[model samples]
Target: MAYRPAGLRTMDEAQDMPPQSPAPAGIGVRGWLRWAWRQLTSMRVALLLLMLLALAALPGAFIPQIPQDPAGVATLRADRPQLATWLERAGLLDIYAAPWFAAIYLLLFISLIGCILPRTKAHITALRAAPSRVPRRLTRFPVRDTHTTTATTEEVTRAVRRALGRRFRVAVTPEGISAERGYLRESGNIVFHLALVGVLVALGAAQMIAYRGQAVVVEGRTFANSLVDYDTFTPGSMVTGDDLDPFTFTLTELTSRFTVDAQARDFAARVVVTEPDGRRYEDTIRVNYPITAAGANIYLAGNGFAPHLTVRDAQGQVAFSQPVPFLPEDDFYTSRGVVKVPDVSPGLDQLGFTGYLLPTALAEEDGLRSVHPQPNAPLIVLDVYTGDLGLDQGIPQNVYQLDTDNMTQVMDGAEEVKVLLAPGEEVELPDGLGTISFESLPRFAAIDLRYDPTLPLLLISALAAMAGLSASLFAPRRRLWVKTTQDEAGHTLIEAAALARGDDPGLQRELERVMTAVRATTPTTPEDT
Candidate 1:
């Protein structure tokens, strides 16, 4: 007899009622779209997203980042403008803050949430339900063993039950025994996923609500939380100017030592800090040791000399006196800078001057050079330009560099300008410009100070993220089931099988343990003697 389709037969039997149209053979576009959505929201999709997220973060870790340090970025841009511009346009300059990077992480987090929430609900339901019944075909299981036992089947079943109860999940039956274990694998998997979500939330919260600021401190200077005080400030989106800490500190003393006899192997700086509360503390701040207090960190980044300069008008009245910071031009300690007398009293006169200070000044074919860092051969060369200094302009200017755009050199006065000066020496001014004087010098160490309210949170979140990654990658959900049965010859048969939803070494070890336990319970027969 030929077989007929079940649907066609049902339709023929119900022909007296009403013939129904056949359902479509294949799902249309809408159905396929729905199916695709379901797949994308599945656990497999979540796993793929996690892998992509890890891969996306690799470039940021390996490459230099602009958001971490803008000065370093500037240096790179100056060295390679074309490559830097392409990187900036491609969002590699600030990878963490890029839109594509943000999208990757956000989608990954959403995928995790989708996977974990439903899985948690399913796990809870399964936990409340009773253990499933043992399948009928014990021989079809992956592992099977046979033994002849003198004890009755009931007694053997009881002994097996007692042994399994100690370490496994047991389901007793009249014919045989069934046991399972390793349910904690699923529990650990859930924990690892939840921990990853926690880490992401913590890091996102810190990045969105934290504030960071940096300031350069010369030795013996105190600064407050003002706009003029900070050399660089990076505030989070939720942070405002008022969120800055009101504390102030002064670098009272700074000490530095270099390896003069050796090949400059060791260098260190010690700084004394005086807080706003009048408490004084000393900290040895070196290249590696950063001082932390009042939500700020102080690092001894560099050191230089601030020479004391004095200026007097033609009438022999003291005009200006202060220590001007100079930058080192060479490793041998030849420093060069300019001084502007904007506060001269002689009818608002302005003077432009350039000077080079040497610790151990020596004349060579290539002009003056300093032999050592210390001021052993103190010498100063000055070049004076007398004209309008353009101080009245409403634009900010660097004190270290002079802007002679609006200035002119006085007639013959440029020739008379002193190019070299020793200690306690003075260069008299003609045409009523001013008399430039070189006084004593004081050693000043350059300190870089910073305050980031969220640095601690960032560090904690990074560590937690690493831990979550390890847990998620190493933990697996697995289950082991052991079923035993009896044959006609009174031989007891044991079968052990395992199911793993993830790949992990621990799960494999657990399966091995279950097999070992089942083998231990099997009875052994003696050889034919």
Candidate 2:
């Protein structure tokens, strides 16, 4: 018979009692914040954020970026204003620089740091501490072995410790010797995370400090490394015109080849570069072969022909005289160009010519087009216009397009007037407007220059990350124990066992090695030891 305490409730009474204090107030804001932090800093969340970053970058690849392809973006806007407006509103046109994209990048960076720091701290602590103690029952371990030898316990213990100490960190315990190896697995994990953080930092720095520009250099004409000289220049957030390298280069010659079917075979350009210190050198640029100068890489992106022309007003005074680069329209070099002669004689109206330059002219049934990529039958056919060239309007215009809004096409009877000329050929303009001469043809090379100071750091970080990942994946982590005791029969009994942190196919073999080491030092009997 037992007597219960007077104030203590029986099982029935406790069951009938009500809940206490609303279950302790539901974990408040601070507790919830701690939970959120733990979730965000988890390795799973870090990987998820990385995947999200990659997914967010996919749209940037397909969309025409405003910084890299401003013309393409402009054309999209002009063709589909509504769609373009929506894309702009969503920041797809400048996806890399978008606020949401930056947020994801920053979050991924922070998550990686958070995940790495705690793991690093724990790993350091583990490395400094001793190996784990041996289990009480070695026979229960998945990989275990027992051996009976005619030797003392001290001899077996010495042999086991010496054998395992060669490869593992051994610690003496009351039960036996505890040995551990492959801390490098955790070390590699920490290094991989650190490298990822480094890569993020380097990328962020590059985005803020790098700059790129494109310029067209005609043969025999020099191109200066300046903002005004570049046809299109995109600077980083922290970049400025003053940051451009002070250098100049002139396109000396161009060599191009085409197949019989008008497909391009090869293109190479020779340029003379002059550094800021007045040192000059010649370099060749071909497709995929870039030149490094003034801390920037110069790549030959495109090649075309620029026809030199001299235009004279009615008074026979030179009005516009320079080379005009034509944009290629086909594989055969059927090019289109516009000549805006806004600087005409004082009393004469401004003249404009919109035309096509056929490298190897061929008269087709539908129209005229180039038959070859070379200048075998070079010809320029143009339609003449007279107007207020709109130069004083302070509005930007495409050099390849002519605005006919304030212009009238010259007419000869019922048809609009047209002029045709070949190299060194001259033609008189109608109404005594001017005389236009095709002086010569020179090749032009479109080059892109880019400078990023963080490229080397980014490359190193990427390589380090790969190496650390390999180590983490291939290096095995294991903890082993070797216990020895003397039985009443004056025989030493040995129990060897191994435990792996993760999947280790060699755990059984490792335990066998320890058992073999113990046997080597002791006299074993043929009793299934």
Candidate 3:
């Protein structure tokens, strides 16, 4: 009788077990509860979890992330409040960081571990066991061949052994020979499943230890890795302010060029960065090029011009004279911003202001428009206001925007509506609030930097998964048996057969070659000649 493994018998018994009595059905009942739990833990359920993980990652990559584009998200929410609220409740805004997405990935990893651990142990045990005995009915096997020979049974067995030794895992018996090969397939399957778990663990570690942030570098400004230096930041759960790197870099120069004749894609910037250790790294950072240093990568995401301006009171004393960063409203040359003069030498006068249109600014029938981003024509249209500029209040205000809520427009009539000021020109305030003078313009670039230490581990896990998959899919397990008996005339009668647990085309061909080689080497006997 053929021996069957204990695990196989247990599997068969479990499948053969009778079904239990049907339970009463209702909404939110015990029957549905039990069914849901059973489905969630099953292999089919785990496969569904894997599919869900793949689907959940799609939106994060396809959609503009709120973490990366907060301004865009704010605009979207403002335009569609109801839809944004629904998406937020469904965890669509931040799908990758959501609890439900994490749960799916975690469960998939658990299922992979559960399936691989026992199979790996079983494969190790099977590899150590002795080769199975040859069956008595060799002719009934899937592959069988016979040939009469004058050579002794031992001689025939030796010839067969030599041929089988070339490629297969073989063992000789007194009757004939038994051989087996291709256990690597099972080993590979286990490896692939284990690697998947490793990948998930690496991703989880990255999420728990990585940090992303953006820091502004003004011209000739030097900054260290500190919370105060960063404009926006997103830190991993385990990362604290003290964990930041102490390395610092100085912005030696920042320059940009705009295409006067071509499209917006022709714009570019060159930034010079000098490390604290006196190492100089000069790189021409473009739209696609990102600089990496000190465990962080910096991307040249955007840029705008900071115009140098000087504000003076009626007495000719300088009130506010510095480079004010003007945010570009659109990609065109039209930039909009405010200039506030709360403190003046003449007196405590409130001066609220709005920037005028630059030269090359396109004007439609209604208002001013920018034809191009380049400053080919230079002009500034000023809108001034005078009132109580609430700068002494505890509440913070944006420098790029003016709070006209507490101020009154001083120049609202046609004669004062649009005061055009050319380059190196000045506009005198009617109420002795201040005098505005345009100076030079300097460009500034926005950069986003990120640091993740678990990238190497993630790559290793990916390679392991590939290796495991190749092994499992190409390797196979097979067995070969040879049974020999002497006929009445004292001549040896040999019968050889082969079988495989799984189909192995390569092993089948190898077995056929061995049988043919053995037949050719064995001597044939004359019968009644």
| CA-lDDT, candidates in order | 0.66, 0.88, 0.71
Q: Is candidate 2 or candidate 3 better by TM-score?
A: 2
lDDT measured at residue 446 in model 1 versus the true structure, 0 to 100: 62
Model 3 Cα lDDT, one tens digit per residue, 225-291: 7778877777776788988776666655665555665256543545555554667666665677777
lDDT of 3: 0.71
- Where in model 3 is the C-alpha error above 4 Å? 1-42, 48-111, 130-168, 174-181, 216-218, 254-292, 301-438, 474-510, 513-529
lDDT of 2 by residue, 1-529 (tens): 8997889998999999997765557788999999998998998998999999999989978888887778789778877999999999999999888999999998888888889889988999999999998888988888888888987777887878777766799988778889999988778878888988989999889888999888889999998989899998888878888888799998999999888988788899999999988999999999999998889999999989999999998999999999999989888888999999988878789999999999999888997788998999999999999988787775556888998999999999999887998999999999999799999999999999989888898899899899899989988899888887877777777888899987899988888877888888856776646
| Residue pairs in clash, model 2 | none
Instruction: Identify the runs in model 1 with alpha carbons over 4 angstroms from their true place.
Output: 1-210, 236-244, 261-284, 313-320, 327-338, 345-349, 352-363, 369-391, 399-401, 407-425, 428-432, 502-523, 526-529
**Which pairs clash inside model 1?**
359-375
- Which 10 residues in a row give candidate 1 its minimum summed lDDT? 261-270
- Measured on C-alpha atoms, candidate 1 has an lDDT of 0.66
TM-score of 2: 0.77
Model 3 poorest ten-residue lDDT run: 261-270
- Which candidate has the highest TM-score of all? 2
Better by lDDT, candidate 3 or 1: 3
